[model samples]
Target: MKNEIIPYILANYPDLQTTKELLIHCHKLGIKYVELGIPFSDPSADGPVIQNAATKACINFNFDNLLAILLDLKKQNINLEITIMTYANPLYIYGISNFYTNFSSANVKGLLVPDIPFEERKVLTRKNHSIKNVWMISDNLPSASLKKIVSNSNFYLYLVAYLGTTGKNIQQSDSLKSTIAQVKKIKDIPVAIGFGIKDKNDVTNILNIADGAIIGTSLIIELDKSLNSAKEFLNNIIL
Candidate 1:
């Protein structure tokens, strides 16, 4: 009940300064958790809205400087649970040896690398206990695979709601309700459903079945309209 929705935001959207302001605004609005998407060359997992945002963000995606921004917010006491979502290549290129150290210095709370699967996650998570490792799953993972991922997650697990990339307006599938319930039965972490929840009603229904909704593309599209429109959009769905 406590975790209602987790908004997935593109870092450096519109540009870096506005993105920082939007993050602070969301925290003030009582949104506790945020996923800061690090733009990669191939954001094939996402749709056009997010892909375009990634293209824009890639211009200014300086890893250390971005962490510095987070560090700056920490000094200002504007604390929001921040997670870096990216592919494995970026982290490896960032130097796995120093990746956790840098992320820790910035007070990053979690990692949601979509390309890494559960069995292989320990290689990263084992190095850093400070950041929570979030596992991703869809409705159709093998039962053994699902249980293994769900078992290791005591913090959060990402449940991909449908089969498509992000930004598509796919409705919740008939199988998702049971999938979420089964995961809840097997593990205790909050399950955040994502990838195609497009409206307030969709959010409400996601909350009804899962602990949280990991909303990304719609929020990106809304913020493009105006920061205020984005705020209003949150107002429409968050209560």
Candidate 2:
């Protein structure tokens, strides 16, 4: 099977028009999944790269406008599986029900709230909502906790490659492989490694053990430079 290459982009970064262009470029590149990050005052889980982006995005960020952009894209028949990533506070501020309703209308495929622990996910998950909750796990999680998270996960498990935040180099070790094996043994799930994948070789190497690679910081850096640079970077990695 072809491995999944999921790009994470900050919503309204630089501006909404650039965000729209990036999504179109992603779809043209045949990328099936794109993580749309909702800008928050404090993105604790991300590194300097994403933090800076979020800071810039929050200057003119409007959740409704973001949804409108997605809706417009859908109207034009440019459909990409969008997973909204944000902290728990933003969702609470938006009103949980309203958040789901808006995203559902925009045809979003999943939600990834890193700050919400597995135990607290019930607040965001509802049977009525079609958006799947994407869980993030790390190598350090206890076996029992890991099992519980994986078993309850809907779309796929996001395996954080390192212990730190995003935008770091991933050193593939036996422990990482062992963690993947443990998850596979518990249940059959597609595991995607995030938190430091930089290039095509990183994606290729990750696919050997996991089902997908989530590229964020490096891609964002290229995107910060220019849209065409971003497109070239994504093309090189996914090819």
Candidate 3:
């Protein structure tokens, strides 16, 4: 709820130390909220950039490592809100109650589970409303169900800007515009849009309607290319 301008982290940083460092850097850049991926063997909804991040994470990272990264943020006194983007299998393995408990204990504000459905959320919601259980509503989600999901979400709704796995794309669709207009009609909760938002111009276009923007692949690509330059660009990205 605290002005969620999420900049996604691939979570597959070259090393844990570097990941922590990058998080610290982002915090310094005045990022209000961050959604970091929990690397899994198969990141089905991810595109090439996220897939590569997951691959690297699997080879060098684990849940404990990710937990350490979060804990490190706490240690650094970074007050930015945190959300974990991951698949459901890991949560099931961790036990939904225990996973929620752990995340709440770590000061995580929310979660983004692409695979979880509204009916399934009822199961987790009972035990975990303490932490924001965020949900996604694509262009495909029915109007009734989307309203239900948004009403249920404690965190602001996450609206995917472009469909097909998270990747770079040019031009917003008429579908996306209608969806935003529809969501605006339903509720006043913060609505943050993501997937392929590349630069300041993208944010400018989205901010007129959306409460905030979530950017990832572009920043990661930039970071992968040059950290310093990426940081400079990030610093320049106004709300």
Give the whole-model CA lDDT for all candidates, comma-separated: 0.81, 0.88, 0.75
List candidate 1 stretches off by more than 4 Å. Answer: none
Model 2's TM-score against the true structure:
0.96
Candidate 1, residue 188: Cα displacement in angstroms equals 1.6
Candidate 2 vs candidate 3: the TM-score winner is 2
Tens digit of per-residue lDDT, candidate 1, span 1-239: 35567888888787778778878887778888888888876887888889988887887677887888898888988888887898888787887657677776676778888888887875575553477788889988988899988888766888898877897875766788888878888976788888998888888888878888888889888999998888788777775
The Cα error of candidate 1 at residue 157, in Å, is: 0.4
Q: What TM-score do all the candidates reach, one by one?
A: 0.93, 0.96, 0.89
Highest-TM-score candidate: 2
lDDT minimum window of 10 residues, candidate 1: 121-130
Reference-based lDDT, residue 181, model 2? 94
What is candidate 1's CA lDDT for residue 25? 80
Off by over 4 Å in 2: none
Model 2 C-alpha lDDT per residue in residues 1-239, reported as the tens digit of each score: 13899999888988899899999988998988888999888999999999998888888787899999999999989989898998998888888888888888786988899999898987886667788888999989999999999998768888999999899898877787999899889888888889999888888888888888899999889988898898899888866
Q: Which residue pairs collide, candidate 3? A: none
Q: Each model's number of backbone clashes?
A: 0, 0, 0
Candidate 3's residue-wise lDDT over 27-63, tens digit each? 8877778887777778888899878877777676666
